[model samples]
Target chain A: MKKAKGSVDEFTQAYMEYYSQVFSSILTKVGNAEDARDLCQEVFLIFFDKFEKIENKRAWLYGTLRNVVYRHYAKKDPGVDIDEVFNDVGLTFTNGFRDTRIIISEALEQIECGEDERTMLDLIATHNFTYGNAAGVLGLTRRQVEYKYGQLVKRILEYLNSKGIKDIAELL
Target chain B: MNTSVEQFHQLLGRYKLSRPVSPGDQEYIINSRKQDLKDLLRKKGKYSLILWIVIAIYAGIRKFGIHITMVQSKIIAGMTAVAVVSGSSTGVYQGTKYVIKAISKPPAKVEEKIDEPDSGMTIPDRRTTEEKTKEEKKKSADIKNQDLDATPLSDVPSL
Candidate 1:
């Protein structure tokens, strides 16, 4: 019983630290707060069940969260394209300056990097991870992370330039 | 216009700010974690039951003296295949139907085409073109033989 309490305490600590980041990641995918919350709950519950076995809790949680999002969309529509789903979420934010959100989201989809690079970008850009922290979570070197970030930014800029948006301030 | 990396990073920061999860949402997720596990287990339980039934049937047929007819055997075999292929505890009813359709259908025929050398266009069946070329060569040879036959003694003197 004491052991059980200890485990619960450990889980709660992890939950408090990573819940918002997990929730935001889900919200980005599902574009619905309620569904994102439900999925976030599911992610943590699974984490709780396998708490003792997890090494690198942040990486495991993010990996599991991504799977949950993929399975949720797959169950919802068996053949849904992920880019299309992201575009739909982008379209939902099309009020005034929110159009910049759509442009940025589209540019992200256009980039040539694989899903891991994009996830790394999300960690640094959305979850506010420092280079060292992001590298720790992603199992990448700091130099590698910086290189990926540079390439991602260059791609986004090139895409925006092609669309005649020369200055990032123009989006603002 | 020179766009600095800092400006791009700031733009991303603003996007993140726009999508913040509310405090109420955070509270709801933390509170409902146990209930979410219960729901997941319930869903998994239904599939587990189906899987157990499939395994029991297979074991019974193989070990016991129980006899199943030809059609029943095919159905059972198909169910087992679907369960294994889907790797799901729940019955893949739709997947089974697709598998049955694929198994029952006849193989499709494919037509092969060849390109004409002069016209640079595709024609059906290279064999037919080969036969046509052979016939043309034979006709040309026959015409040349007829011209040589007509030339006769005069052509012999020139030789």
Candidate 2:
């Protein structure tokens, strides 16, 4: 029950505050609940230990989380580099999605699939997870993910096509 | 293979991730924190055990031999400490002064004082040494005469 170097609640409160985002990120990255738990714990343990001296708490946690996730992936598969897809996508459809985004969101929300496929879509389409990473998350093979994810995309496209006049290029 | 498909995939993920996490995920966050606190307490307990062990070892050392002293020795040691603290300052100062003097010895050969003839010096009293002695004796005699003259007339033998 002894407090850490600083106030006792600091680590606990920070744990409560940032754990979800960090856990979600780690889960998204490592694609395993158990590994994400362990890795997120590792990040927070470091955070707890250095809590007193750290300045930018969120930044410190995120930075440490990144390294921890990277190390986890590296240990799992030496060739896997998640950093390549870590950056946000810059596409023509993003900025002016004001009208199209509502349509897209509605269309995507209407489409339903199995929990596995839903989790897969959540990982790949929502969480910025790559096909291989999504496969790892869903416990599916990479080839299966590519095929299924492509089918899902085609379904979404067809749905969009059905809801609209042809020429998908016009939305662009 | 299509650029649009890839962009949509990424874009959808971005929007989904931006939304608030589901309530189910809160359970994970809370459980992990409980684990953190549990592990932290274990670590603190470990450190405290080590600290207590250190304290116990130090207590044992004191109780066994090293710092154990007879009352007489303790009193004597206390008196010695008091003496050193209260009485040593002047001694230290004197010792330091002498040590400084000893360290910086004066240049080996002291310059001898040369004596000169008194002829060059003017004697303010203007009397020769012999005359000075004679004048001193005469002054003492005059003092005696004055003393004799100071006797009261009543003290003279009744005529």
For model 2, the chain A TM-score is 0.49
Please write out the lDDT profile of model 2 over residues A9-111, one tens digit for every residue.
Answer: 4554455445555777777666667887888878877776678889877678878988887787778688875655243323334564555676676666667
Interface Cα RMSD of candidate 1:
17.1
- DockQ, per model, reads 0.06, 0.04
Displacement of residue A98 (Cα, Å) in model 1 is 4.5
**lDDT by residue (tens digit), candidate 1, A14-104:** 5544665687778777878789878887898788778888987878997898788888999979997765554454445544556667777
- Those runs of model 2 whose alpha carbons end farther than 4 Å from true positions after fitting are A1-5, A85-172, B1-25, B44-159
Overlapping backbone residue pairs in candidate 2 total: 2
Give the per-residue lDDT digits (tens) of candidate 2, residues B55-115: 2333233323233222333355567567878788978989999999998997789789988
Predicted model 2 interface RMSD? 20.5
